[model samples]
Target: MSDKDSESISDAELDRQAEVWEKIAHRPEFEKLLTAKARFIVPACVFFLVYYFALVVLVGWFPELSKKRIGPANLAYWFAFSQFFMAWIVAWIYVRAAGRFDRLSDELLGEHAQPSETPEK
Candidate 1:
């Protein structure tokens, strides 16, 4: 084919791809998944930020938490220990929320399916 013909073919292909993408983007299932992801992401991020800031503020405003103690340890060290517990709690909360969100999302997006029937052993 001539250069002009090849260029026209390429342009047509690009337009076709764009149309296909537009259709996919407008599909209900795609929108639902996007919404679900946003729901999970936004809350998780908020929780993480709030949790971190709370710890920082607590340590900054509470002098007892920063005081030194025996055994080369300080109040900050003990407060940091408590922060580890907070980390565990946050992690657990995130896992539970993400799992529940995933299950609901699968239902909403019509991605989950039951297993096939099987005979007893």
Candidate 2:
């Protein structure tokens, strides 16, 4: 085959692949997933930042809150330990939100439909 013919074939294949990808990307279910991700990510980010800053401010401004007496551990060390608890709380919140989002998307997409029954059934 001529070089031109091979180039045309490659172009056609590329176009076909692009169209398939476009369709998949534009599917309603895919769009819903994207929306759900955006919803989860934005709020989770805000919450994480707020929680982190609050922890920092509380540790800096409130000595009583950070006070600690576990052997050589200082108030800052205890406060740092509490930050892990806050991290777990944020993780739980994110997981819950993501689960809710997934459920909503599945419902919206009618993903709970059972498989088609055979004539024998």
Candidate 3:
């Protein structure tokens, strides 16, 4: 969406799109997508932040936890590995959720896009 693209649209078409956008804002599917994304993203962000904060605190205040050896590697190594694991898990979750979001977005666009306003290959 660019200013030039919007500028090419007639006032009536712009108004129509605005109305469509307003309706899309109220649509259950759009709302559901938002809620679902928030549910996944908020927790994931919080979990990552907490993990990061804990790591900082542990390394700063308590060095013994990171020193404890689980195998050939220490607890710090395992913690570092867990960060990578958590990142991969979040990426996987986002990729899965993105498909759902795209579907919902396409459905919304289908309801709104006029023949000319819609892109043509």
Best by lDDT: 3
Question: Could you give candidate 2's per-residue lDDT for residues 11-101 as a string of tens digits?
Answer: 6776765676576567777777788889788887887788678768877897886676676887667667777897898788879888877
What's the residue-level lDDT of 81 in candidate 3?
80
Give the worst 10-residue stretch by lDDT in candidate 1.
112-121
Residue 101 miss distance in model 2 (angstroms): 4.7
Best by TM-score: 3
**Candidate 3: regions farther than 4 A off:** 4-20, 115-121
- Ranking of candidates on TM-score, top first: 3, 2, 1
- Compared with the true structure, what per-residue lDDT tens digits does model 1 show for residues 33-70? 67766887788778767867776776789777568684
Residue 120 shift from truth in candidate 2, angstroms = 33
Candidate 2 deviant stretches above 4 angstroms: 1-9, 53-81, 101-121
Q: Model 1 reaches what TM-score against the true structure?
A: 0.50
List the candidates ranked by lDDT, beginning with the highest.
Answer: 3, 2, 1
Judged by lDDT against the true structure, how good is candidate 1? 0.65
Q: Is candidate 1 or candidate 2 better by lDDT?
A: 2
All models: lDDT?
Answer: 0.65, 0.70, 0.78
lDDT of 3 by residue, 1-121 (tens): 4546667779997787687567757778778778877888898889889987887787778788889999889888788788888888878988998898889788866875566654432
Candidate 2 residue-wise lDDT at 10: 68
